[model samples]
Target: MTALMTAELAWYATGRFYRANDGSLADYGYFLHLPFADAPLFDGKPSETSAHFTFAATPFKADGIDNGALSLGLDPVGQFSLYLQRRPGATFADPASFAQGECIATFRRTSLVVGTTVAASLTSASGAILGTNVFSARLIASNPFEFAGKLYDLAQTVGMGITQFGTAATTPVAPPPPGYDLVLPFTGSAIALGRAG
Candidate 1:
């Protein structure tokens, strides 16, 4: 048998939970609404509508912990897709045209990304590491499209970092590892479509 030395990253061992304003756990990973651009049609202009996009979060396993806190990384290894469910006269033949009857536009694009984050703990005065922070970088490419009879490419970069805050009081817990700390709260932004080679 082969000897194996496996070290599990903090982000994998410890799960991150998110709650909405009403305190319900937020299920979806990423959420956004993107509007379509106007295009020239046979008679009238192409219909303009918005597509709802959603992405689920998945963990990127790391090698090991350095310094004191745990480090987690994110790359665009996950899948990305889009949905357009409401359009006028939309159909497969004339998907985005006003004369068509198709109401949905679906596409899956190829993407990749790379980034790192530190897990820390939250304190009344100072902060610590609780091994629940997540950081990541992502590069996404839109499905190739032909505009004006020419092929064009579109891509995007997304950087994200997140941590939790607070803990259940009353349940006295043991101190974490020597350098480990508590969790902090964070908000992040996303990138849609960008130019790519």
Candidate 2:
């Protein structure tokens, strides 16, 4: 039997902001330093076959910051959605780099604003077995709140990305719009489960 490998989820998020004053776009972005996972995603034999993964998270305090301060200046899930992406040949080794492969799952909401406790979980199957030895995932949040120089009704939807486990380097889906200061990153680690082999 192949040796079992432990995996932790890592990522970085970028938020597109807007101003309620002149309908201008602003807010750069921030990184979230996540805590270690409570347990390994999988503890079974390694294989390049189909599998299901569930990713979940909550918005809360972190780094002396109370809750996620991305848009509304507070920690709120802001969006109630989850997503996954796994192409054939994906693996658990060095799973931070989400380049390209079979898309097992993906969920990005245009309008999702909810607390951590009510947040939804994402899942998907690679189908017939596919993926590398490492586990990798990508969470996309596309919600910008702030209209006419005022904080829009649910204008705090963005997370950080993780490239290396210990490295400080991370990436975002898009850069912060001009004149916008990306809000703070959210605390609380997301959940990743190896649903099946």
Candidate 3:
């Protein structure tokens, strides 16, 4: 009878922010994640598929305020994925396919703004001639904020494209059936803003 076993893996990241201009004000803060997983074969083996996380300070920029006071914010975004492919044998210098890895998840953020202004003036000459003038102005701003994060696990599976096995045996193959369970987690954050001066 074939034997079966299970494994687990995990990862995490963190960061801090200080005011680049003024020590009293916090300019930005952030955190990011690298890929990780849990499985028997995954021990020390290089990961085929991996993920990254990112985070940053909010309210990147602001303008058009009577007072110079500025407000800040934060946001996060990232991606995650898993790997499926066979591990190269000890003697196999270049195995057809190492670990087939891919990203299956993603995230993002968005924001926008618009504005307008108008003015008019008139003047009279000594004779009877009159002169008039009118002026108008419009301003628009569109700023987008984005953040993302991701987590992933590694596994053994078949190759793709030219590396695909013959039709009869083309089906993807997962070594150790149950495979390894890895948890590589990551996080990211950021903020952006636009305004008319």
Candidate 4:
């Protein structure tokens, strides 16, 4: 799929649960959001009018936490889903842009574990693959979540790394909010589009 060039904030992460770090339940996964260039979301965030993917995750260890937008504010023990939203309404079941007839897309991961594949598909108003992102996720958690992307390639949006939400940044079982991190340290090729996310 095409990259959101104007969306300056790029999020990075690395996740692993249930696994003990040196006999402790401390997680090495982290969530960090940083400013990036060359991507656009049409109407960027921090603005009233915005449209982009809502990155979220759900745990296999839980019993159905939340579905779409609800999961963004729920506990960190849920599966991950990317919901397309356009602000104004910018809400669950009814994103603001849904009424304006904006493009809609959905991204989901199979297992909410340390490593897995995240598949994303962009469709037209009638549901067609006429547009998209090349983001493919890596199935392993590592220190310093690496965001490998090639800016020279317009079809490169596939990045690898663990992405934790609303929870401990480095510790899996830790608390939330204070440790929210989306690590997208620009390596120039941090967003590899045209692949899988």
The candidate maximizing lDDT is 4
lDDT of each: 0.25, 0.24, 0.19, 0.27
Clashes of each: 24, 53, 32, 54
The TM-scores, one per candidate, come to: 0.28, 0.20, 0.18, 0.27
The alpha-carbon deviation from the true structure for residue 53 of candidate 4, after best TM-score superposition, in angstroms, is 3.2
Q: Using TM-score, give the best candidate's number.
A: 1
| Candidate 2 Cα errors over 4 Å, as ranges | 1-113, 116-177
Please give, for residues 1-197, the per-residue lDDT of candidate 2 as tens digits. Answer: 11112233433332222221233222222123222123222224423222212222222221111233211122222222322223323232212212232222233322222222111110111121211111123334323322224331111211332122111111222233343222211223333322234
Clashes of 2: 53
Decoy 2 TM-score against native: 0.20
Order the candidates by TM-score, highest first — what do you get?
1, 4, 2, 3
Question: By summed lDDT, which 10 consecutive residues of candidate 2 come out lowest?
Answer: 117-126
Reference-based lDDT, residue 174, model 3: 25
Candidate number that wins on TM-score, 1 or 2: 1
On lDDT, who's better, 2 or 3? 2
Write candidate 1's Cα lDDT for 69-162 as tens digits. Answer: 4343223334323222223233212122222232122222233332223442122212333322222323333443433344323221111211
Model 3 Cα RMSD, Å?
26.2
Judged by lDDT against the true structure, how good is candidate 2?
0.24
